[model samples]
Target: MELLETMLRSISAFTLMMLIARILGKSTIAQMTYHDFVAVITLGAITANLAFNNTISIRILLTSLLTFTGIAYLLMFFSMKNRKLRSWFSGKPTVLIQEGKIMESNMRKLKITLDTLNQELRGKNIFNIQEVQYAVLELNGSISVLPKPESQPVTRKDLHLKNQSEPAFPIELIMDGDIIDANLQQNDITREWLHSQIKKKGLSIENVNYAVISSNGNLYFDEYKDQIEHPVDKE
Candidate 1:
């Protein structure tokens, strides 16, 4: 009887926690801001007690979980509507570098060392700090880097090439041998047309592992079997 009671309590706690997580949305799981971190730790503690502490009534544990979730939801809703509240909750971005110069004072205030700054810059694929014109520390603890104009990648405009306009985003046409009907309808691409494109490459829908309409309106296909003369990275 005791074992059955423990099993029921565990299942009940797990179900409630899953429901709470779904209600919180992706931001709660994806980005770990200071408040989000605190809330997650608190929720885990409550869940652990609710699952194993048979002495505590299930109703009281559930009420606590629901109340906390309601408060978090209200806070998120209000933060979206008000800029000041959003800033207060998530914190503001800090300018750490400007005009190829490090803001030493700001770094000191944030308790960030020179080594930490360099590490963040390297994560942005910037090995030389001299190449950076601006770097801002975001609320999510990521460093946004702007390379110096001379160090930035050259665009077609720099080469005086003719400008061509295309779709701003790529569309997936097929995945795992299945067609994306909604994408096909939205892009005005008929299934027959896509099949013909595949046939041109001497392939069929089943042969394609993935297919996409690129931003430049080019149809690209990847087959399950790849023919490579030499694989450079094969170990």
Candidate 2:
């Protein structure tokens, strides 16, 4: 009976956690703000105790979870409505670099070192800080960089070229031999058209391991039986 109770407790706690996480939306761990970080940690700690701590009552655990989630929801609601509250809770983005000049005062206030700044800059494919016109340290601890005019990627406008190309919103049509019906519907594509494309490749939908509609409306597919040599692991 004790073992059965333990199993039941684990399952219940797991289900409750999934439901609560869904309510919190899909912000990944790296994207979570300071408040979200604390909330996630607290939730995990609470859920862990609820699942494994035999002494804690299910009623108390459930109540605590619901209360915490409710409070979190309220905080989100108020923060959205009030700028001051939002600023206080979520904080604001800091200017780390502006016009090729490092904001030393802002960096010092943010407790960021020169090396750390350089490392982040390198991560953004920027080795030289002088190339950056603007660099914003986001609330989520990510650096958003705007390169200097001379360092920026050359575009069609720069070359005086016209009709370069339209934006290509590629859509995944099939994955693991399963058709993504929603994507097809979103892209206004029919299964008949897809089948016709597959025929051109001398294959069928079931033979496809993965498929995508490219920007040029071309159907690209990888057949399940296609043999391709993978690169050796470098890492």
Candidate 3:
């Protein structure tokens, strides 16, 4: 009877800890305040210790976890209910770029270096910072950018183009130098046809680094590998 009681007590503590964690949900280190993050970690560690410590009272652990969770829930609820409070806790979005100009002051405030900002801009295919109209720094420490009107690519609406056919389905061609045979067969394309295309680029299908066939029958291939030197691993 004593053994069964101990087992039941441990199981109950485990269940209680899990329930509290589930209620709190997920948030990144950048999103969570220092106090909130520390509290969550401390609560989890204490609960873990309590689970293994048979002598420590389960009531104490349960009470503390429940209290931490309840407070978190209340704070989240309050953040949602009040606009000013939400802004105060979560922070206002910082405008990094306005009217195609970089706001250096805002960037400094966010503590994000110019190199990191430029890297993100390059990922979005905006090579020149001057091309960007507005880039807002979100609370999640991510940038959302708007390109200048003059630099914006022409859309179907801009061209006055109307599509009568069904939406195009993306057809996978080559992934990491490996030809997707299933995609080729599904798209009614032959291996010989693919080889012909690769040969035109002065390469073979086996040598292709990456390629894709868009739903609109547009073939994009990147066969030539540019050698990038890495100081850490390079001889």
Clashes of 2: 0
User: What lDDT would each prediction earn against the true structure?
Assistant: 0.81, 0.81, 0.71
Worst 10 residues of 1 by lDDT: 161-170
For all predicted structures, in order, the TM-scores are: 0.63, 0.64, 0.52
Give per-candidate clash totals.
0, 0, 0
Q: Write the per-residue lDDT of candidate 1 for residues 61-169, one digit (tens) a residue.
A: 8888778778777777776666568768878778898778899998998999999999999998899999987888877788888787567777867578465542234
RMSD of each: 12.9, 13.3, 17.2
Tens digits of per-residue lDDT for model 2, 115-197: 99999999999999888878889989999887775687887666995433432445789866778788799879899988898
Superposed by TM-score, candidate 3 places the C-alpha of residue 121 at a distance from the truth, in angstroms, of: 2.5
The residue ranges of model 3 lying beyond 4 angstroms of the native Cα positions read 1-18, 21-57, 161-235
Q: Give lDDT: candidate 2, residue 76.
A: 70
- TM-score of predicted structure 1: 0.63
For candidate 3, the per-residue lDDT at 89 reads 69
